[model samples]
Target: MQLAVLGSPIGQALSPVLHRAAFQALGLDWTYHAIDCTPDRLASFLGELDDTWAGLSLTMPLKQSVVPLLDRASDTVVRTGAANTIVVSDGQLIGENTDLYGMTQALSDAGVTTACGVTVLGAGATACTALAAAHELGCDRATVIARNAGRARQFLGPAAERIGVKVRITPWTTAPAHLEAELVISALPPGAADELAPLWKPAAGTLMDVLYRPWPTPLAQAAATAGRRVIGGLPMLVHQAARQVELQTKCPRPPYEDMLTAASAAVHQLDTTT
Candidate 1:
């Protein structure tokens, strides 16, 4: 069977490597690749797939765009209006969000089982998932720090409401003040929060930045120096892709450790100390 991860700038995606490793570990001959796909081309691209395709992992703009094209959407996808994993069942497309699961699992693996206070940085699609993940981790409310609070409220409000999680919109400039929350999830793009690194002095919070390629992001590094728990995005990426592998192949356990090892090796090529 075949699988792929789709996004506009997909060259940096580790989904192919992660999922391919999962396939190998499960002893299944599968092909997974990265496809540069924009929102405009998603529908047609999904339409052109043959029966040989099993599933797909999505990144960035494609996550929300692919929701409308799905024959069925999981509850998380329906609530957040985003689907990062798609399962091809009997030629039907079923949308599922392993990102929320991956985030919760990542936090759990880092010894954070629950968070009373949670703060999310940036209000993009990933931020939506972060909010839901925070809720899953026992957080009833979350603070969304975005460059534009208005845009953040507009995009993230309904999702929060549907998830029954209250969210407060705050300007991104105030991000440094909210780092003391039980959990701080940085949903900003790679390098978007680099300038904030100098100002980051997290107070007793676990920092989870959702950018793995350039591991130990500037903000995360600063938090770690302060003796705070810091988690890179690789764990979440591996767990999410592992769930994708399970959904695609029907295997109960998809060898997540293998996936992590593969992803770590791939990122090590660029940054050795991940």
Candidate 2:
């Protein structure tokens, strides 16, 4: 079977590396690659797929954009308005979000099992998943800091409600006020929140920056320097890709450690080469 991670500016995507390591460890002769696909080309790309394709992983702009193009979507997709995984089951295209699961697992590995209040940065599709993960971690209230309130509320409002969390969306200026939350997730893309790094307050809560390529993002660096626990996006990326492998291959035991090794190596290679 074949699978690929799809998105524009997919240069930094490591889903293929993670999934390839997963399939290899599972002893499956499956192939996973990365494709440069944009929102406008998503439909055409799906239309061109053959039975050889088993699953797809989406990133960035393609996550929310591909929702309307799926034959069916999971409840998480319905509520969150985003999905990063698509499984070609039988003859139907099924959309699912493994990000929430990924985040919880990633946090658990970092010794965070419960959070009461959370502050999320950059309310995008990944922020929706961050909210869901917070919910799973026993959080009932969240504060979202985003540059665009409309887009943030559009996706986060219903997702929080359905996931049973009360979320308040605020402008980026109010971000520092909520730095004391039990867990703060920087769902922003790399470098997007660099300006706010200088404003990062020393707090007791953990900070999870959802960008792995450059290791310590400015925000992450500030948080760490301030004595806050920090988690990079690599572990979350591996966990989510492992879930996608399970969904696509029906493999009960996906080798997450192997995938982590491969993903870490790939990230290091990209970081050094470019």
Residue 79 Cα positional deviation in candidate 1, in Å, after optimal superposition: 1.4
Q: How far off is residue 257 in model 1, in Å?
A: 1.1
Off by over 4 Å in 2: none
User: Candidate 1, residues 126-228: lDDT per residue as tens digits?
Assistant: 8999989888888899999999999888889998998778999999888878878888899998889988787756367789998886767888888898767
TM-score of each model, paired residue for residue: 0.96, 0.96
**How many pairs of residues collide in each model?**
0, 0
Q: What is the lDDT of residue 113 in candidate 2?
A: 98
Poorest lDDT segment (10 consecutive residues) of candidate 2:
196-205
Model 2 compared with the native: what TM-score? 0.96
In model 1, what is the error at residue 179, expressed in angstroms? 1.6
Give the residue spans of candidate 1 off by over 4 A. Answer: 272-274
